[model samples]
Target: MPAFVINNHGGDTPDFDGEITFYVIVCVFLTAFGGLMFGYDLGISGGVTAMDDFLKEFFKEVYEKKQHVHENNYCKYDNHVLQLFTSSLYIAALLASFVASKVCTQMGRKPTMQIASLFFIIGVGLQAGSVSIEMIVCGRITLGIGVGFANQAVPLFLSELAPAKMRGALNICFQLFITIGIFVAGIINYFTSDIHPHGWRISLSLAMVPAVILLCGSLTICETPTSLIERRNFIKGKATLKKIRGTDNVTAEFESIVNASETARQIKNPFSTLLKPSSRPPLIIAILLQVFQQFTGINAIMFYAPVFFQTVGFGNNASLLSTVITGLVNVFSTLVSIYMVDRVGRRILLLEACVQMFLTQTVIGLILLTDLKPTGSWNHAEALIVVILVCVFVMGFAWSWGPLGWLIPSEIFPLEIRTTGFAFAVSSNMLFTFIIAQAFLSMLCHMRAGIFFFFAVWILVMGLLTHFFLPETKGVPIDAMVEKVWKQHWFWKRYMVDVDDEVIKEQVHPHVKYVKYGF
Candidate 1:
């Protein structure tokens, strides 16, 4: 068991009386391991694609017969085959995520995570031992199911555990772990890239280490205080809350949670309630934000970064090295986001990132459109410029869409339907992710530089949508956000609304806190 130490890292004080405790941080850190595994699965393919030995073994005819094909960059598989390899996992993930929504509610968060971990380990074993393409696809699909559960559960668990003031930062830590996973995968792939006969298998199998760790970590942590209270086990909830908050005086905190739970309990049917007009605003934002997140072209680049580098004139070694560097930049930039999310707010950073990304993608597209020599033969300056643009693009994504996309939807819904709503949003994310990741190579093979232009256009569309719909959620109580932010019909309303503590008292449902608090 990890030591439960109370390390006080100073920051904007949380909504509670005391500092955020070390237990809260440890629970969140361990839960965020799911993201690391998710990123590892997304990234390991890029390295495997670069391995001729793996490709030659898996896609025999394509590798042997295609004399003029770009052997080193692409895996030499036909477009249909590549599409199947990537999209199959996403298809399974979509289904599993819906199931996880119910599983988390029934079995609770920790058990749900262990379920995901088990699936991940099983899939990894199959992938490493695979002797056929069919077997690899099967493994990927199983892994996707695990990813679906992990992705849906981890952020929700973090949000429920976090104090309102620190929620955004802790939630952003989930994205940071994702980049770390990608970085680790890239580094592993780099060192093993030359290990010809079975290096790719070794790379695919290394993810098991983290999956096991996450399962063990989940065992040691407490269930979310929110879930505990909602279950009407007030005595246990109070105890858990004290452990997490590290103080005995939880009167205000307990009342707040009771109020939130009572409010969520208002619905007769979660689905019917979501269909109501009052709920439309937040629900729409959740779905569209997820859609926009995937369409940002982040995964198209991440899942194939090495191949992209090779496409732009990098040699095999240089391409993998460049991918590792991109992963590092992604991690560092997300740390910037985790630190700044509460201070700067979500919309501003998202807007700034969208502008930079729009410009970078447009420029990269235009450059690629120009007649350029193949991988090893392009101008050194031109190749360097392309690399620089990709780096900037990744940095922009890491700070904005990468973390905020996962963070916002988790907090946007009321607790009554939060699991169902978040599950749908996550499914949307993977659905669009499937479309983008599956079509990327096909688009690159046929449309070539046009692929970048296609992505840049989507970025513009998303930027417009964000400006109109996204709100500043930093330090806002989840229920308060529902009444004041999402329920407000107009975009400018969030900035215009004003409220003091008396007004807040009026806004909170009187019957909720009083009855649930037994006073």
Candidate 2:
């Protein structure tokens, strides 16, 4: 390992040393504790929802009222208040994303993250100590706000700070931590489900561990050099860049970043600037990418894994164990994506994942409908098959959409409007995520295995979108990407051909035709 990993100092020149220094690793990964908190909160909810005592304590009134008589409805809750309780956090996150964007742009990355940690601490406190259902809802909304802020800031923090070579993998670390959080929560849920009412509280409160880590860690790290420079503290920016980069040769690079900031500041309207022809391509791509990510229904699994397992014939303990296995596979698959993202490029991984997901989802749906008829069919062998298929479905998603979904939006936007643009994109994520998370259980209950068919169709659609619009951005310098692709026509024949970065820098302007191959 080298002494430090370069964070957030991208410019015209990129260092390809592939050095993994301890300082750089700690700074980036620990700061990613914010992501860990994101994951833990997501993971905790499923387990808590799965807890029998939790339902008996908090959901007793509704349960007794709707036990025998129920109406089949799309999202009328079907009297399952758990769906509303779970999706409420995402609803709060949707609103909070816009606010987090402003804080990210105005207060700087580290400071914005610090505020997020504060929210997490308070939210976790409320949730852990809650005596009533209303209090738990309040805690979830508060935690959602914290997560929304972290989701907005963390990916940008990684992209802006790490060396160009490390940018993709480092950004992926955030998504990776999300899986780790889910995995940890799965284990906690598994053990606590049998512990009675207090065990549910313990599971929910465990998120505090990562929340505290994020809070204390954010205090130790310096602000991103670019954020500092944008704030007109070029002196401190330069110093911080050197400390993380472990080099004194950041002067030219510093000047380049300063120049970009100055150019963006001269723009009178950040919002309208994205409407210009030069900015349309990246902005549209980023927006649609978020749509595709959520529509894939990964969160439906993450949030409702235990519920799905139980529906397919697994007992409570078995269901939680299967959830834990899913979390483990989710984390490991992300590591695979991080390893190959730069080497293999973004487009192929997305395409392959889409294909695999499409296949797995279709098959999983078919098996559930045919073999396990859900009424009289009781076969452990078929249940095990369903579980295995779900694992394969998760493996398909873990590497592709899960990581790149966050990365592409973070990197594609120009420095001037990156924060604003990305926050808007993330807000879209929360928006669709809320829709999916809220309606997922209803879909499963009403549609049965057809829910898998629903997600499979979406996976196929996302693949087409990727084929037509997504660009091959691996190993391209941030400056080069902004210059070469940002100004191109949105519908141009830029079907993500593998262009040499060196050649890209050599050609200042494009010809009328970008590439011969058109999707």
Q: List lDDT for all candidates, in order.
A: 0.80, 0.77
Which lDDT tens digits does candidate 2 get at residues 83-122? 7778778878878888887788779998778888889889
lDDT of 1 by residue, 33-109 (tens): 99998888887877787667777888666547334444532333336675677778888898899899888766788
Model 2 segments more than 4 A misplaced: 1-20, 61-80, 487-519
TM-score, candidate number 2? 0.88
RMSD of each: 5.9, 7.4
Per-candidate TM equals: 0.90, 0.88
Give the CA lDDT, 0 to 100, for residue 380 in model 2. Answer: 75
Model 2: ten consecutive residues of lowest lDDT: 510-519
Query: For model 1, what is the alpha-carbon lDDT of residue 265?
Result: 62
For every model in order, what is the number of clashing pairs? 0, 7
